[model samples]
Target: MTPAPSLAELEADCWQQLATALEQKQNRTESHGFQTMTVATCTHLGADARTVVLRQVDADRKYVWFHTDARAEKVIQLEAFPNAVLLLWDPAQQIQLRLTIEPRLHTDDHVADDHWQKLWVGGRKQYLSAHTPGSVQPAPYPGFPPELGENLPSPEESEAGRPNFAVIECRVLAVDYLRLSRAGQTRARFEYEPNERFNWLAP
Candidate 1:
């Protein structure tokens, strides 16, 4: 295997890539960008993966965040295994970010509450559904209760789901960045094995 980059180089490159990826709001809603990340987790039997939105990225801290319904099956999987991975590919930029992370679920913490408050009324509507996430019910259901008077529930009606809405904080342990370009492709990995130490991977 090729030698990893020096500690300083690894840290600099990882932060630079992350800052560029998250700073581009254009990618947030783009077809294939930060929003379209594959979240990999472990279940009782083995590993599992699914697409999830990327809610936040803190380059300085080398961490990322995402949201999920506490009732989702993935939450159960996460509870079983705190280790997870996030895979993001930006077709527009021909770049991919593979992040190995340690996840912590924020349910009732002040952090989760802050995120919930910022959610729009329409976005908050998602958690107001009658049935739990991934539930099998007779006939199809829209998830939310049929009636909400005329508008989305005030924070009170939505408050019940606050505990149900969870924010997943992913502390990045390592990140592998692969970019495909006309001038040959480039690949590199950054490893922060120690909570405080960082190392680089050869391209």
Candidate 2:
């Protein structure tokens, strides 16, 4: 058996997995569990949560980001309450990461521009929707023009979605990491906000 990793090694593993996901080095399903994440936001009535694709990660800054429509309900919720939780689970690893984060919206800035340039036509198609996200529709909507069903949009045509494209960047304040096992579950917390700290937690 291998020796148990030091606290620092465990933390580095977490960041490495995130970075690998951004690099797309692994197949989507086989990605180290961060290809997608669940974002929970506060609303007037209660809490709201939805799944979003993970777009980018910066281990140095401890930041991760994803894109959404400018008119998304979650965006509106984040505008009101910038604090949220991001949840990720890797079934293969039997591990979970719960991140407390402060989210910021970037609609028109170098950050947004850079991310926009990275998106391919297919990824940009949803932003071309005529209606806002979560809006009720008379009939089912493709989230884009009907004519473009199951078809990739042209680069020029996709450029029109730029105005609706928005990026949500999360400054992860703390990470609660858990690895489930029959022998024993391992858990730890890594905090970065008020001060950087790391410690094992009761699993």
Candidate 3:
């Protein structure tokens, strides 16, 4: 990694990349490279990571959101230690963003409800699956409720998992953004602590 740019430049670049990534709904694919990040959580045993979708991002780019099953192991890990890392990479952009944050769970309230309401029927169907997340099954499982029966479940069925559904709110403490291009590679970092500052780095 080479020396990074001053904090101001880093921050500006981060904002630009983040905004651009969000604005483009389709860039040769359905999801933005930032949407699915490798969520790293600390457990008593060690660190664990899994890919999760990017549910929402604040205007300031300081906050990001993801949804998960309440029964998931990561939920338990977050409760123990809220600090986590979201690692995002875009093969198309040849860029990677590493966000270190403190995660807060949205249990029940307007925040969770609004996100739930925004979900499409197909998305809502995920919660209707009867099988518990991470549970052992005798046969191959698709991670959904058995016997979906011709139509999506009523609001009640979807709501059944509402309690089990959880939203992960990440308040970014730092973002390390790296970009690779033909015009040489560039890397930078922006930190929220010790005052907001951006620093350039060697690719």
lDDT winner among the candidates? 2
> Who is ahead in TM-score, 2 or 3?
2
What's the CA RMSD of model 1 in angstroms? 4.4
Model 1: per-residue lDDT, tens digit, 14-133? 566555655564354434366658999998888989998766778777788888888889988988888889998877778788999999989888989888987766677778776788
TM, every model: 0.80, 0.96, 0.84
lDDT of 3 by residue, 1-203 (tens): 87756667666666666666665642434555765779999999889999997777774758888888878889989999889999989888888889999899986888888888777666777776577788889997766676775668776667666766778888999888788889788787788865887677787
Best by TM-score: 2
Count residue pairs with overlapping backbones in model 2. 0
Candidates ranked by TM-score: 2, 3, 1
Question: Where does the lowest 10-residue lDDT sum fall in candidate 3?
Answer: 23-32
Q: What is the RMSD of candidate 2?
A: 1.5
Q: lDDT of all the models against the reference?
A: 0.77, 0.91, 0.78
What's the distance in Å from true for residue 123, model 1?
1.6
TM-score of candidate 1 to 2 decimals: 0.80
lDDT value, residue 136 of candidate 1: 86
Runs in model 2 lying further than 4 Å from the true structure: 25-30
lDDT of 2 by residue, 1-203 (tens): 99998889999999998887767733444456678899999999999999998888888899999889999999999999889999999888898999999999999999999999989898999998988888899998889999998999999999999999999999999999999999899999999989999999999
